[model samples]
Target: MTAIIHDAVIVTGDDEDTVHYGASIAIDGTRIAAIGPNAELQQRYPSAERIDGRGRMVMPGFANTHTHLTMTLARGVFEDLSPPHKPPFSGGLSPIPLPDMTQDERRVMAQLGALECLRSGVTFMLEDSSDIDDYAETLAGSGLRFLFGERAYDRTGTAIGDPAPFQLDRAMGEKHMATIERTFAKWNGKADGRIRIAISAWAPDMCSPELLKDLSALQSKLGTWITIHLNQIWGEVAAVQAHRNRLPTEYLADLGFLNDKVICAHCRCMDPREEKLLGDAKVIVAFNAAIAARRGLSPRIDSLERQGCTITMGSDNMAEDMVEVMRTGLFMERVRREDGRNPTPEQALRWASRNGYKAFGMADGGWLAAGNKADLIVIDTQRAHLVPMLRAVSNFVHNGQARDVQSVMVDGRWLMRDGKVLTMDEPAIVAQAQEVANKAWSRQFKKRFDKPPAGFSPAALP
Candidate 1:
């Protein structure tokens, strides 16, 4: 079927960063067939389905390159806690443990995350998590493009910044490797290539040297994408120094794991030397700004970009809104470099869209072009806050809310239209997620303590 979204402001996130005031995008099957002046395209595809794009801004959908979708359950619980970063390092990234959930409940939570992504105009994402097989089908059914990373780590450290002894659980490592292979075989290229698989070692401090070597070899053998948390916190940095006698980037390099196919998330604690090393390797850095700011940290994004590393944005934990991620990224970088004029909204938009797609190996996506994939979003510009849209992209970046998203199209199909998700039951998913999260947190607190954290309250289970 052919459809034409006509008569809107088109923000072509192409190499030239083109913008069209009254343009139309013609979608033929799963690819954009044409893009040009609205009247011209309307005549060109006269018989196609016409989607009135009046008072809307059509742009390539945002790509969230790094996030843990299932961690949506921890939204209110973990955001306020600050993990220790001092000499007496803690064993984990957070004090609260991950709440336990049944497989069905986990599926509901994953779908809830997908719902938020759709509502917020994210068409693509890279999700790094353990046991992705549990909700792979659920995510696929949500009609969003995904790269699922089957995470594996042998270290028994409870949290990410654990300075405990690194025990080599070879058997467990092998089992995880097998799980990765199985997950890839089962889910890679599923949903007509909308779903892909990747390799993930949870963190530098959580994986042993031998396991890293094996994972690198496996990555090369399979020729798949790899992602890992790198130098996320000061404790993690100190732990790696104590164990490997080298920085995290150097350790990954020694294991032959720092390369273009790898995406390093949360490089917030890196030094200039490590930045140079990562840049030399040409790896993509997932500059997860929202979570970084919540954790009271920010990466040297400008320096990393200057060093030839591609800067992509991710929502990380607790949230899946790429809009928030993009804006936060811009603000954080400006504050970090003390240059408000540099790293403009246009650059931040590219990082959130184009760079993210490139990191996930989608060469023709995350941009609006004739030959590019038809993964885009339409934001209603008729809202009061979005009025006087003198500068479309800049205004959208600084003032737009997720509620302004009017439609989401993926692979030439409207996954969401007129602010309604067509692929899943949104209200049902949200209600179920709330119920499941309450029970899960209640179970965790009852199993461990009588009181919840300060300023935190889990909904009482009925």
Candidate 2:
């Protein structure tokens, strides 16, 4: 598969933040073969398929460091339901529980999430869940790169943020281990190295010390990556403190689970000492900025980066819009710093693209280079909101919408072209997923609420 997109603006999200105008990128097989002026690329690749790029800006696609793909089912319901940050913590992120779905239903919802990711120009994802195999095959067929982390934990009788007494569930932990191993065997290094696998510790409050140590050992033994939810909420922090008499980061540190290969998601509610501890470990922080804003929290991205942490961006739960994540991270950091010019758009794009791709162990991706992987997106820059494009990178970063994404390519294959999805049936996926979510919510509300509350109207379910 050889192709050339000629006469486009290229935003190479490299360390130098180079932007090339009137340039062309030549893709050969699964790698970028050449980048040069339009005539030069045309002359070089004479037999390649040509794509007009006069009104588009081509850049690296996003690599989301952390997200739960099936959480797309809770989109309209969960964003408005956040747990209290004070004492007497709630069990999980929301007081209202989500309706459970069958494996097939979950597969549909995961497809919906994948649709959103492709539409929003996400090429890579790290899915954190206890059971990824349920929808693993379905997502693999989507042609996007992924790093799957199958979770294992020992504590029972409580959800993520509950302060209940820890009950060791050794059998359940072993069950998770078996599933993790099975999933790894089935999918790790699959798709010709387009997909990778990882070991996941659910959370410090949810996993016992023995289980954490075991997970760490397994990660080392397998020579794989590790990921965890670290200090996501104050309730989880309180729960960890009560359970171990130490902060969540301290617990992981004591168990020797903190390392450079570990991708820590949501360090929003950590103490300054704990933050410093994570930075000292040189961990990568998946700064899920949009979800943090929904919960009215934010991570200390600057301080963490300064203290030696590699900062990356994630869409997290209930969303898959990396454009929103990148822009929101920029706005949040600017407001936090009270200085608008500190972390530039280039830096934010690096966190969203380059840093995340590096964290996913794809150093050859998320940037524009002659020999790098051909993973990139084309944005339609002829829209009204994108005009006056003196600063192309800043214009796209600050004001770009997901709808601006016109084409997406991963491994030199087009997953989306000119607003049409190529991998999955978008209409069928969306229709089935809408029914799945509607029925799930209807069932939950019917189970919990006897009558509709004021200002609440349930959807008419099939």
Candidate 3:
């Protein structure tokens, strides 16, 4: 089916960062067929289905390069809690513990995350999690492109950021390696190539040298992409230094894991030397700004970009809103460097879209251009806050919210239209997520403490 979206402001996130007013885009199947002035396209595709784009701004959809999809279950509980940074740092990423969930429950939770992604205009994402086989099909069915990383690690006795001795479990590493292979065999390139599989060693501190070497070899063998959490927090840096006698980036580099195809997430706590190493290796850094800011941290994004490392954005934990991620990244970097004029909105938008797509191996996506993949979003500018839209990209970047997204299209299909998701039941998913979260937290509290936690009544569970 052919569809023409006409008479809107089009932000083509191309090399020149083109902005076309009163423009139109034609989509044929899974690719963009043509783009030009509205009147010109209207006459060119006279028989195409017309989508009125009046009072709307169309642009490339956001790409989230790092996220824990099922961690949406920990939204309210973990956002406010973070690992201690001072002396006597525990080896856990968060003060609150996540509730154990069954495979079916995980699938439901992941679906909930996908619902948020579609609503928030995230067309593509790279999800870092273990045993993704459970929810791979469910996520693929959500009508969003995904790269699922089957995460593996050898340090199992303690959580990340714990100040305890490192324990390497070779058996656990082997099992995870096997799981990665199985996940690739089962889900890689599924959903008509909308779903791809990648390799993940959970974190530099949590993985042993042997496991890292094996994972690197497996990645080369499979010729797949790789992602890992590198120097995310002070505690992680300390742990890696204590165990490896080198910086986290140095350790990974020695393991032959730092390369162009590797996407290293949360490089917030790194030094100039490490940045230089990553840049020299031509790695893609997943600058997860929202979560970093929430955790009282921010990466030197400008430095990394200047050093020749590609900068991409991710929502990370607790949320999946790439709009928030993009804006937060921009603001955080500006504050970090105290340069309001540098790292403009257009650069941030490119990082959130095209850079992430390139990191995930979709060079043709994350941009609005003829012959590019039709992964784009339409935002309704007919809102109180978005009025006086003198600058389309600037206004949307600084003042826009996710609610302004009126439509989202991926692979030439309307996943969301008129502020509604087409592939998933929105209300039902929200209600189910609330129920699951409440029950799971309650059960966890009761199981661990043998009683309901303060302010949480057991009677609330049905």
Candidate 4:
């Protein structure tokens, strides 16, 4: 298959961060055949189908390094349920309980999240969750490049951020390892090599020392990447210190688990020494900016990058808008550094796209170049917010919205075109997801609380 997206603005999220005007992309099969002037590409691939890009801008799709597709069900409610940062910390992100659902309902929510990702021009994603295989079918059919970081942990009586005493269950830990292996065996190379499964340690405080060592060894044996939640909050930091007698980063480093292949999410509540060690290990930091903002926290992205760590971006749980993630990351870092122009929009675009592609081991994608993977998006440039594009990339970085993305392509295939997703039934998924969420939450919230939050509305959410 061959096609030409002719006459568009090309923002190459590459190391050079090049932006080419009035250019076209020639895609042959699953790779980009060329990138050149409109006349040149049209003359080169005469027989190819031409996609009119007259008022559109073409750029690499986003790489969401961490997210929970199934957890999308926690959207409106969980954003406000962030855990406490002060003393006497609990292990999990929030003490609030989420409604339980059947596997079918979970699948619907995952599909809805996938719909959101496609709509937002997220071509690549890394989903960190337990029993990820339950939703592997949903992801496999979504036409998105993704890494399923299957979670494994052995701690009983608590979750990640709890300061409670560690209670290790070797049998349960063994079961999780077995599940990881089974999932890998079943789905690692599926989806024409688009879907990959990676090992994940839940968090520093949740996994025992022996469990961490075993998971690390397993990762090496499988020749795959690993991800973890590290320093997500002060409570989490306290929990790790109380249990392992060391900081979170120190615990991972002491077990020889910190490496270039590891993707650490939420390094917000870190000690200076921990930051230095993470930089020394050269791990890729998954700056989950939106969730951090929701939790009133932000990572030291600039310091981590300067210290030798590769910085990338992720949407994290309860959200799927990579556009928001990228923009929020830029704003957060600027405020953290107190510099108006320190981490430029170009830098944020690099972290969100190119850096993330490399982190997921898809080095050929996430950038526009000949012979690279044909994973890109087309945005409508004629919108009111996108007018007067004197500085194309700058304007996009500062002002682009997810709704502006009208088409998405992965490996030369149209996952979405003209604002319509091709791989899934969008309307059915949306309606079914809403139905499931409403029924589930209505039942759970009623069972738990006597009344809704102060200004309760009978019609807000029945």
Candidate 5:
């Protein structure tokens, strides 16, 4: 089947990167066939089905390099927990006692999160899964392209409410490995080669050195990608330095785990030496700006980028809004550099889109060009913030929101059209997810506390 998107502003992913004023994109099967002026493409593919892209800007959808799909329930649930806002895993008081949610609850929440990603112009994601078996069905049904990172941990007594203690044991670790292998066999190259599995290790503190080494070896054996959080907080930095007598990056590098296939999230505390190590190892650094800002941590984006390090963007905690991430990224860098013009919108877009694909060892998607994957999003140009657009891409990075996204296509299929999802029933998914999360949070909070805090009424959630 052939389809041509006509009379649109095409942002071709080229080094010169000139926007085609009235171009058309022809898709043959799942790959882009041609990108040129509308007249040229129309004459080229005369009989193809046409999509009128008038009054719209078509660009490659953003790649969310790191995300916890099931963490959607935690959104806005723990905002004011403590001073500096203690995370659920921390020993400090938690705003809401995150209850033990079942696999079914996670699936419902994950489905809602997936739909949110599509609506926000995110076509690809590197999603971390707790139990691959439980959510495999939900992931399979999600039309969005993603990489499932099977998470593992072996250390115990590290933090409060940590899942690592429950996941410890060499036998249990091997069982998790078996699940990953089975998942890869069944899902890798499935859904028309849009989904693949990666081996994920929890942070160094949560996982022992032996577990990290074993997981690294397993990743190599399976030819899969590896992901881990590195230097997310000062406390983690202190612990790693105290235990290993080196920085977090140095410890990971010493394990022979630093490589191009490895993605290290939140290198906010990395210095020049560690930055160079990451650059030399060709490691992909996920700069999760939204979460970093919320936690009062920020990465040195320009410094790392200039040092030959490749950086990508991730929403991290379920702030699934890409525009928020981009804006936060721009502001974070500007604030750090004390130079408002240091990181431009173009650079921010590159991190959010192209760099994310490069991080995952996929080169075909993340840009609008011939022969790339047909994963692109369309933004309505008529919105108030989008009006008077002298520069289209800049306006998109700076002013556009998720609601501005009109349609989205992944693997030549419309996952969302006219702001409505086609593959999943979004309203039903959201309702079920809200119900389960509310019940879970309420029960957990009640059990953890004798009396609720002042002004905290046990009201029903939306």
Candidate 6:
């Protein structure tokens, strides 16, 4: 299939921070064939299907580096609890244990999360989903790029249901390994290399050292990625410190798991040594600024960049909007630096685009250029927030939102066209998700009353 997008302002990351006006891009199958002025491309490929890009700013679609897709079912389910006031890791909301999730529930939740990603201009996602045997099957036809990391834990009573400590017995380990192998064989490199599988060990506190070591070995043997929740909260950090007498990053490093293939979701509490170790290991930090702000945690962007760690954007919670992630990242860095001009708009754009592909191991993606993957986003420049566009890129970082996303394409295929989804039926997905959520909520009516005497209303089940 050949696609030619014409008459657009192209934000091509081929050059450092450059946007070409009155340009066009030609996609031959999954790769970009040419990128130049519209007149030249039209002359070159006269018979190609023309996609008029008038009044649009075309850029690369976002790569969400880290997320828990199935957790979409828990969005509002735990917001109203008494805030974790324990010192050190003393903030952020907690999710209610949802042991009642069936395969159908898992499918619906995964679809809902994928729907949110599509709507929010997310071209790719790295998800840490639970131990649902059919997780990949549930997501098989969803038509979004994904890296499904099958969750692993060896702690007893830690997962949602068991009254005793959470532990993965040998039988459970074999089951998890077999399921992951099958998932990898089925979904890895599917949708034209848009999907893959990873080995996910929840956290140091959640997984035993032996399990962590085993996971690292399997990740290396399978030549896939490893994702872990590292230093997300202060409690996790404190627990690691007490157990290993080292920071979480240092401990992971000691285990030989903090390498380039590892995408650590949040480095909210990383110190100088840990930052250096991450950079030395070439680990990418999935900078989820919005959810971090919601939980009162922020990344050390400047320091991380200085240490040469690749930082990419992600919407950790159901806050699936990438524009909000970009805006939050820009503002949060400035506020943290206490200087208005700290993180330049150009830098913010890089984190949201090019660096995102780096985190996803898609070096040829997140850029608009010849020979790159045609994962593009077309923004409506005519919108109110985009008007008076003296500086397009700067305005994008400062004022843009997801609704400004006019179109989206992944692997040269039009997943969305002119602000409408094409791969999935939006109305139908929403309706089905709402029905499932309503039924799930009704099943446990009093599960709602466990809310704090003083706090926000509990998040209803999805």
Q: What is candidate 1's TM-score against the reference?
A: 0.98
What lDDT does the true structure give each of the candidates? Answer: 0.89, 0.89, 0.88, 0.88, 0.78, 0.76
TM-score of each model, in listed order: 0.98, 0.97, 0.97, 0.97, 0.92, 0.91
How do the residues 167-267 of candidate 5 rate in per-residue lDDT, one tens digit apiece?
Answer: 34676566666777777787787776778889888776666677788888888888989988887765566556656678888888898888989888888
Model 5: number of backbone collisions: 0
For residue 116, give model 4's deviation from the true position in Å: 0.7
Better of 5 and 6 by lDDT: 5
Q: Highest lDDT: give the candidate number.
A: 2
Model 3 TM-score (2 dp):
0.97
Task: Please provide, for model 6 over 51-158, each residue's C-alpha lDDT reduced to its tens digit, 9 standing for 90 to 100.
Answer: 887888888888888876766765654434323424534323364444356678777777788877877788888888766345665555556678888877766544
Name the lDDT of candidate 2.
Answer: 0.89
Model 2 alpha-carbon drift over 4 Å, by segment: 450-457, 460-462
Tens digit per residue, CA lDDT, model 3, 326-398: 8999899889899988789999999999999988888999998889999999999999999998888888999
Q: Model 1 segments beyond 4 Å from truth?
A: 458-462
Q: Model 6, poorest ten-residue lDDT window?
A: 157-166
Off by over 4 Å in 3: 450-462
Clashing pairs in 4: 90-161, 90-162, 91-161, 91-162
Give candidate 1's error at residue 82 in angstroms: 2.3
Query: Looking at candidate 1, what is the lDDT of residue 113?
Result: 85
Q: Over the full model, what C-alpha lDDT does candidate 3 score relative to the true structure?
A: 0.88
Off by over 4 Å in 5: 82-97, 160-172, 450-457, 460-462
